[model samples]
Target: MTGAEAEGVRLQKVLANAGVASRRVSEQLIVEGRVRVNGVVVTELGSRIDPENDLVDVDGTAVQLDQSKRYVMLNKPTGVVSSMKDDRGRPDLRRFTKDWDERLYNVGRLDAETSGLLVLTNDGGLAHVLAHPSFGVTKVYIAKVEGAVTPQTVQRLLRGVDLDDGSIAADKARLLSTSAEGGGSLIELTLHAGRNRIVRRMMAAVGHPVVELVRRQFGPLHLGTLPAGRARELTKVERGALLTLARQAAGDDTVVRDGGEDPHTDQEI
Candidate 1:
């Protein structure tokens, strides 16, 4: 065996263990020039790589080869706090995550009264990029608010509204429907979650206080049909999307687990 191969782990094994596929399929992918290491196509069957330092991608999507790094999506039900543990002793994230072996934490937060897509991961670097408002990562929310919302209200939301802290606006706002029974309106608003209770506050400022709110999307992730109170590990495609966004948000393509703990992990939406 060459010293280079001896010094590094087999590339196929790395890909397979990273959930690319089985060893045989990974070998096929490598031999077919479908895998790249550090920006170079590596087709040799005996190819090996420094798993920790080398960047790898398959079919143009960056692959996170660390086995310990986990990304999970939870459909957080209303009333559960966004932390691993709540100091107030309220329903917390632990109930949904207790079964996982790795310690996962929320990338950001949804208000206790709100529910929907929440990302939990052990990858601190990605969390930092995603949680910090400075990155301008946007979230989509469907808020059911009081009273019949008019076209004027939607236009106002799209234009901007002044709150006590500052002026805020939705990137997109559309009236979804109106409740005939309660005379409430369902409005979908997409905006950067840059402040505390921004959605509820914005709705209140528009004279349609939110009765219920649920986040439907965060960055590139969609809540989909995942049931409330259930959590699922992100699929390979989803992981790739997140890694892509993290790279864009952090302005670094080589973001890694050891990038450091995200201090803004608990930042609320």
Candidate 2:
């Protein structure tokens, strides 16, 4: 092997880049001696392998460097848990991803009662950026509340709401539609917070108590009419848009937007 090939990349980094797991988790796997190189168990953290020439395996599965990453958008249905597996026998996101052979995990989470766009991917780096609130990745939701959502309520939501966790504010909130007799209303809200049940908590804090909440868009990807409980691989254009969004959120000016706009407005839902 050439000197450059002999040097190779760090084993953990190779595993992470291959979407086996996050870098930290990959290190854990290495330390546990679950990773093998050239048919020998390797637990050294600094070990490196030429992915092209070295025989690397994790838990008996050959670690082949994937040229194509898998990115899936699932229109999760209510009552299904956003998990790969559930110990309590609850419906899980796995039901939609069973056909996929590549290892993937949900980017973020949707509670059992909430439904709509949930991104699942084998790209750990992108998933980390999208899930981190510091990235300011916007998530838009349409909330049907128990009370008539007035202009004042939208103003209140924009101004901020106090939850048990902390203060939270919506980037934008507007009434989409209201039921007759002024009993209930469908309101569109946009926010960057990733706190658990944040949308439901925010609406409840404003005395409007969410009756049904559906995420309409995540970053540049929209739920559209994808049908509930079904998953589809993201198109090349969609994947590029998501990566662009992640780069922009990370303050990486080197990457251009490529004419893809952030789906932050109510009209995009």
- Who wins the lDDT comparison? 1
* Candidate number with greatest TM-score: 1
Candidate 2, run of 10 with poorest lDDT = 259-268
Candidate 1 backbone collisions, by pair: none
Worst 10 residues of 1 by lDDT: 255-264
Stretches off by above 4 angstroms in model 1 are 1-6, 43-46, 179-182, 261-263
As for candidate 2, its clashing pairs are: none
What is the C-alpha lDDT profile of model 1 across 1-269, one tens digit per residue?
Answer: 23456799899999988888899999999989999887688999888888877778888777887777888999999988888888999999999987789888888888889999999888888888887777888889999999989899999999999999899989999999987677799999998756888999999998899999999998999999999999999998999888767765765555543555443564465
lDDT of each: 0.85, 0.77
Give TM-scores for every candidate, taking all chains together and pairing residue i with residue i: 0.88, 0.70
lDDT (C-alpha) at residue 133 in model 2: 79
